[model samples]
Target: MRTSKTFSIQFWMDTKKSKKSEGLIYARINVDQKRLSISLKRKLAIKQWDSKNQKHLGASQTAKEFNRYLDLSKSKLFRCYQELRDNGEEVTSKAIKNLFLNEESNGYTLHELINYHSIKIENTHAIGSIRNFKVTEGYIARFLKKKRIDDISLSKLNFEFLCDFENFLNAYYPKGHPKAMSHNTVTKHIQRLRKIVTLAYNLEWIKDDPFRRWKSTFDKVDREFLSDSELARLATHHFKIDRLDRVRDLFVFSSYTGIAFVDIRNLTNQNVWIGDDNGNKWITTTRQKTNCKVKIPLLFRAEKILNKYDGHPVTEISETLLPKITNEKANLYLKEIAAEVGIQKNLTFHMARHTFATTVALSNGMPIETVSKILGHTKITTTQIYARVMDHKIKSDMDAVQKRLNEKARKFEEESELKNLREKIVEAEKTKYANLTKEQLIEKLNEVLNEKSDTN
Candidate 1:
């Protein structure tokens, strides 16, 4: 059971932040004699305000619009009060105001929602990913400051608010960044924002999604992968420095095995196993990103890398099969490796995984289903992203079709020649018989048939 509480609302003028002749309107909500004031963000000229009636003084167009807005606001507030009571929530000035302001009973603010979203995902999400959410938190805080508000309730968030935030992100250029955000970068930030807001909706903290009308899209990016020649060049290049040598081996290992840097960083000797049937060595682990199982047969190239670093001092210290290196430092060293080897692409650790997907596996006639499983993809469609980018795969598939068509083309030409010969003989026979009488033609045809039958 819930206690019933008295509730009422009254409109008033707040001129503190307004010009001398105009005053900002606010709705003062009263529950049990306690009061909460909500700024309507609407203003009216002081001279035209009617305090007793709580409306504009005149019937002119602007006055009529202002008065109409006040009327609707009053009716909406009353309805909100009734609904809160009907829902059995404590009827208080803040609760009523929160409800009328577009908040559910939970009454979450923007910053509060950000905090909740952070804590909710902190355990499950990676540190880098959580840092990104913090970046968004800074943006929202700055946006509120730009709008001259300390914070905003999720109820107060609207389509216009989101569009403004997106525009703010589009124009923002932090120091050290060469330019403003790109389409995909902006989309990424916006995507994180949407995810946070969606969490609110999913938790039933908000009745609606402010981003319902807002759409976010990203441009198609060409995922860079190593070609066969490039892979060979990088794999075979030896560096004098032991550090560079180890980094190169790591990158080449990923190229052969399609494992990510983070996953590789955690790999130990225990991850290896001998196959039951074929007795091949295999690396079996779960992808850190998706927590999906990854079981890839260790190719000889990958095995050679493992053997090279087997029981190395670094590996012994880390208790891993390969020497441990920070992903960042390893990639930085790879740039030098690229310059030394004369390969002309922006090389990164992840590109090695892409190379394995296309150049090392898919291009070598490995099945896509098998590739998806090896990559620990929950769905085959996720693997197809790599497939679509392989233009040579597209051409190679068509080459087989083109070969079959070439074979049939010659046979078709021979049949066409025979058809021409038959038509020519028919024309020649017509001409030959045209000069002969009908009886003579019949006698010649019968004589030809009799000779052919007797020979048979």
Candidate 2:
């Protein structure tokens, strides 16, 4: 149950709109009942045009060539229509017009694809994802300029082009950035490029995938988090400065709840509610990064922090659960707090999330499946990357193994004692058999054979 489509093209001139002696040539396209027109950017005098045949009425070489060009344009338009239809794209007059103009609907360019992707994900993807697309687009524009290329066609994307682009990225750095691009950063750009390329291929804008041979990988990085003692120190140490105290409270809250900075900053009273299990308070909200729902039960410490900030002037005005502060200022204050408290770890808001996953959750005998759910991770592997194994976990595992080994050794000793008893019994039977005379042994054997035959 699909509608059939029809396409037709014609050459014409708008005599009423023409202000010059020669009228401008145009190609008119009709798709089903819809119509559209594209200017050929050429002009022909009324006397030179053949109205009946839609050709120039002349024998001059210039006239013949112009007629041939018109025929070629018509043929190309038909081919574009057929290709689009075969690719299962809805054939519209505007789509055909864009194809003729080398726009994104047909012959997609790198810049056009980037813009399209940016617009497409504006509402659907995270802010970080959108920013990455914009940054990638800027880098691509610079790369093209450095190579003296106007624009790259989707068909021309290959391994060689990717290598050149990678080289360009290594040498290129954005303005105001402190350092050159790293391998992982360059790899991310290539990943975004691959995503766009895959989209183009799915849409039939490109026949071959250029990234088929390209390999992308990221180096593992060690992330820092607080230990249980360090977290307790931060919680107990009182600061004279009010701002530092507030930042400490916020960081500690995140460490206990496993919430990121953006999600924590946007938390409201509505997100906190009494759970059915023992009426414990819980935070029910959606993670901004993955849009996954996270329901974390607020521990005593996290609840106390919230209670301390309840009904504050800033919180009341903002209708949020906590006072709002810029992330930059929070990190700056964290460094000062860390220095004052003698904690050497580079303290950041995000590190609190890592701490929650490691020290507060996994290190305390929490299941990784539950931790992954609490952290709003789409996969358990992602949580594993975030959670680091502490020395205590290893020691606990080895302790369990040693206990199992002791139990196994005890069982083996008991089995060996039983085995010795059975051997003694066998020796006593052998002595009894050896004491029997040959005639008595032969009589016993004959009697056992007769009993076995009767049972069979």
Candidate 3:
């Protein structure tokens, strides 16, 4: 039997149950997206095994001797593989593992790890985030089917598997989506895969990080937000459809308060607060995405919307601060709202947060730190992303400086021209008199001095 180029041999430790000092080493044989593992029956100190170099770390006698044993085991495995091939026997990881271990098998499968991870994180993560992972799982299942693969052993999932998955995502045009997945969108799927693989590595189910050499690249996206005029129009415009009005009000509330759609959906009256002075109103909640605490002073417009829906049927029934609706439908109605208001940008519920950052807050000179706090961002850099997209802010910042510079430069040029003109006029007076008698020169000089300046 012939061996495939995808075949590889690696040594890793069973560190999950090991004491801090040492761990038992195992050999993994990989071929064609499958893996078979067998213990090398050697224990090495945790610090001695350099995972990256796949060998011992230092030049000491013990390290040298241990690495020599690892090298000898590798050569023995290679000999077994060569013997199998020369004998015209089937060459597979399982076949080689059987010869090496002379016994039973134990390895984590891809789906097994995913199922474990899913069950493990089901309680901690948000439903939307869990659902998104499930959607990625579906894509993975589809990819495996397309490649005629039943399942991959987690230890055998290499860089090439990720590359194929990325290619699949790039070409995937699911129903109702406008086009194939975008660059950043494709990166997102692989990102999910990386998370899963990283979890397995951390759990000691795998030895080396399959993604060690892989790097994900993302394209910068220009997010859309409403202009002041469009926002005002959308805020004030009355829609004939009642559902459109509710969606618009919620969107406008988010635009005013900068709350995310999921967090907005989960708001309640308890989230609203009044100052001890009993004058100021506020909305306080934890961000669903970041789990960071948020406290926003309610603006007049946002408070009005809240009051308008107070004790209303939908809010009362749903036990929320406002009418409840799916994000899908809210975004759908936002399209209608955009067309009614004559705005050209493709609107999404998240853009309301962008509008708050760019048009409402940053454009109006609100400090980014305050905006970052109100938005429940853990890092100031996260808020800076919204700040970076404010083209209007950029234009306004440069406007006065550019205008002042241009005016000063023009004034200097005029002064220089005026000085040159005066010098030329004096020269002309001197030359005109040089060709004349003394009396004519004096008369011409007097006449020229008396004449009004035509340069004016």
Candidate 4:
């Protein structure tokens, strides 16, 4: 069986300083082949040493932290190799490096893999996932600089390391930013890292998948949709009366259609079909996201918008149904419209997709499964968020039911009043019978009973 080599990065405090004395500095680097690892050691500030206080002034008390760092790198590497060897694979430092350096693994070093795998999803896997992966990559690099793609080891990836990175992200991120990553963001990076590491293992690059049991830390996001009041406000919002207006209208159109921006950009006159086959005029098209064809009974408003924009001049001479607007400009216009409508939420191209899912589709009592297909979500869970927003519809139905019950009660009260009046008239007639001595009490009682029954 093969074995991994052991190494350590040592830190030492320097006592001598040639300049104005500051706190002592320490430095570290790994060495294994009997060569001295060189680094500039931090100098202790003898001038600031407090004999009475028994502490070094102007020095960060990070001796324990520095020691932990040294232990972490060595221990993580050893544990990673042990995991591989336990899994019935020969393990050595060279073998580990060779596995990590394989070009098929995206030329990631061991350190890169450890750090990269710490994140759940990576941008390299797909085009749409790039934005998030780029953010994750930047965060890791900012905290841990210049990590070679091949130097990652398991010991470097314990729970503490993951937590520390998350803390670092939260602390360093600027205040009041909506897109600032959460714990779940950290988890996604880790998950992606795990997936890539698993690939490496299958390729015999590493002996074991250390992240196989790792879990994520993000709570479910409350997917919000526009309320009726918000939608009404949006409809009346006056967008900038220019090309930006065109972009806004297209975005609104997509919200109603539940088409993603990518799909909308690719749309053309050919994609729209009027089906007389169903004995009614319906706009039929397939969503590019899910490749699912949908036939929506055309609303007059939707049809009007479509016709107004039909065959609009495209300067680019492309077959796109709408004039091409860059995503950045579109987003800017959306934010402007959102502000005009008093929507405090940050508006994006993707928000239009969510608006369609909740406002245009699910709130109208559409089945979630159908909505999912319309939105082209790969999972039912993706569609489930709309179900949560449908709570208001359930409340509306309950209110309608209560209104009906109240109306029924009012009608019953009116009938009861008439019955009481008829009873009183029969009693008056009986009282008059005593004076006349001809009208019978039995006839009065029968009249009253008949009147009450008729009223009922």
Candidate 5:
């Protein structure tokens, strides 16, 4: 059975809740015998409220303005009800009240949405991802505070607001910081914001997409890696300090295997196994950041280093494959190692993986596809970033072309010399035949044929 829908708005003063001579004004909504109430955020004396007419009672200017406001509010509430009914939505007093309050029933403020999204993904997302979202939420809150806004309705979010937020992010600095964020850092923050906005839009909390027309661009940065010579120096150089020696060994291991620090830290004996091909040892592990499987054939030097630390106390106690150290200390020790080795590039544990991808694999004619798999890259494009075009690779490519060109030139020269010799012999024979008559030429041809037959 179909039920009739009814909605009506009325203004009244709550005399029972009045603590002083003035009572607070309230709007009461009624739909199909159900009721919902909301404060109108105004106050009037009990004597001024007209119970029968549902309006202010005086003819003064203040009373006239208050009555006009109340009339407008009532009309807007009725329009809200009519629109909801026309749109085939359930016409309830509460729905009409929400519309009148300018708050979408399913909407959330920006910060609230961010927090909600963060909580939703707290367990499923990686720690780095969760931290980034948290930082992004803080940035958004600061931006809103700077604008002196307590909260913004999702419906009020538009392209202009996004632009203003982006501008704020570009100019934002942490406390005691002298410079604003870098270009890529700002891009990252905006990306997180876009994700939250997209979630809201997908959930139908917002009608319009604020980021539809905006394009995010990040600056390309040149990642640093060690050259072959520098890598060799680090590999062969003997450090007097035992701590530096251990760090060097770990870095060299990464340079050979292309495994990242976190994955290496989590490695154990079980991860190393004999490959079916060639019966050589291989490191099979999953990347910590992307969770992509990486299988790398252990190089001679890498195998040697592993064997060297076979019975170390730290490795045994930690139940890890290698001597483990904190990432902070590893990087700090790498700096000292860089200085000791007389290398200019800043040494980080991650750069070891880059060196393995470029210097050890690509420059030595290893296929990019194989390099990408060894490095645990989900995309070849990501591997390409580490495989910068090296000077030696360029030289080797050009040298192969030069060698082919030289061989072609030499063959052409030999063919030209043979052609010139044949032309000279024909000219000499023709000159000798010119001095004789036709009979003499016939005789000479017969004689030459006889001489050739005799020689055969």
Candidate 6:
């Protein structure tokens, strides 16, 4: 037996009969002291009725649904109902029905649902995944700690919360950073929230989904990649101190290799290999971030750099390829290098990967597919960011093409003028030859010829 009301629930009742039937558990719900119960067959017929009020309780289907509703409204069946009844003002059935209809019967008040889903994900996924979920869940908990889950209605998740949380993340832990949390980071948080909310809907935790009106903050994020000129400046810049200079070189090297700092720290001479058939040396490694293997051809500059450090004993000294330095010290030196090279953009260790993708590969006219493979990007779309930045290179290429066309046009004009001069010279020779007539030449030339012959 079952009952239905503003909320729906399922209850398990112990039965005396050895053979259990559909109506083994008789569900009862009190509506102003009126008890409603439906047998197994009746509960089945109205199982789909989301909500049936006192007015609609006349029909048999509605009556059974009402009883099932009552069954679900039991003390244990209703989650967070006590809080709602205590703190919330008397809400009309129509208002509650509106909430149910708004979410399309997903069941609103999603705190429990979010937590439950987070727990499941934590159990089944990686430690990093669980950590990220807990972080997002912490944000949600702090945001709605005072309010009941049901009170976190669709309208409450406005733009204010989004902006406020962004500011919060900016001030989180670190008291002052030059900038707030990155748009991509904040967007990830929002995405996690969306995932949990979606899970809640599927699990029937909340009746209304608040995320329908929500939009991603991803597009508006300031995800910057270093330019080729900026990268070149870092590579060629002269640092005052040897320590800073070596840091710059190593960072630039890692950028060219497209490997993260952690993986770069693990690099050894063994990781470098010369191709057998082609006889070309390349760095064969995998990215720590994506765990994808990458094989990047050794540029001449890269080979030269390695040759300089090849004989150096691997130690924590500046001579080593990867001189052991803390991330903070490494980044500090990188900032100085950027400043010395007249690069206005903020420099960081991670930017090296972007620099390699944008400068060493895409800017050099290498195909994006090839670049993506070199960078070990899981998806081509991740590599498409370089394509967007490559527009400036496209413009520069157009300028080169125009310059070539102009040079060719000038050469063609000069050739045409030379041909005209040659034609004129030929015509002049023909006119000069035609001027001497044969008869006059024979009579007049006889005396001259005799004189010339005698002189000869």
Question: Would you estimate the TM-scores of all the predictions?
Answer: 0.73, 0.70, 0.69, 0.56, 0.73, 0.57
Model 6 has an lDDT value of 0.64
For candidate 5, what is the TM-score?
0.73
**Residue 150 shift from truth in candidate 3, angstroms:** 1.7
Give me the runs in candidate 5 sitting further than 4 Å from their true place.
1-106, 175-178, 277-279, 440-456
Clashing pairs in 1: none
Candidate 3 residues 264-379, lDDT tens each? 98998889888559789999999887789998898888999999999899888999999999999999998988888788989999999999998899889899999999889999
Q: What order do you get sorting by TM-score, best first?
A: 1, 5, 2, 3, 6, 4
lDDT of 4 by residue, 1-456 (tens): 544365433444445544665545332333245323222233445565444433344436564454455455445444544565678676644543433333223344555554545353442244455555556566666666533342445434445656666667666654577566666666777665555557557644544455655566668787666766776576556765766567767766777777777777776676666567765445457664455676655555455557667766762377666767888888888777777668888878787778877877778878888888767677889677655555678899899999999999999998999999999998987677766433566777789899999999
lDDT of 5: 0.86
Residue 232 displacement in candidate 2 (angstroms): 1.7
Residue 366, candidate 4: how far off, in angstroms? 1.0
Give the residue spans of candidate 6 off by over 4 A.
1-138, 141-174, 178-188, 219-233, 236-242, 307-321, 388-392, 399-456
Enumerate clash totals for all models, in the order shown: 0, 0, 0, 25, 0, 17
Report the lDDT of model 1 for residue 434. 91
CA deviation > 4 Å runs, candidate 1? 1-106, 126-128, 388-402, 428-456
Candidate 2 structure quality by residue, lDDT tens digits, 212-311: 8888989988999999899999999999999999999999999999998889999999999999768899999999899999999999999999998899
What lDDT is obtained when candidate 4 is compared to the true structure?
A: 0.61
Quantify all predictions' global Cα lDDT against the true fold. 0.86, 0.88, 0.85, 0.61, 0.86, 0.64
Compared with the true structure, what per-residue lDDT tens digits does model 6 show for residues 63-138? 6665655554444323333333555644333333343234433344446566678678755665557788888878
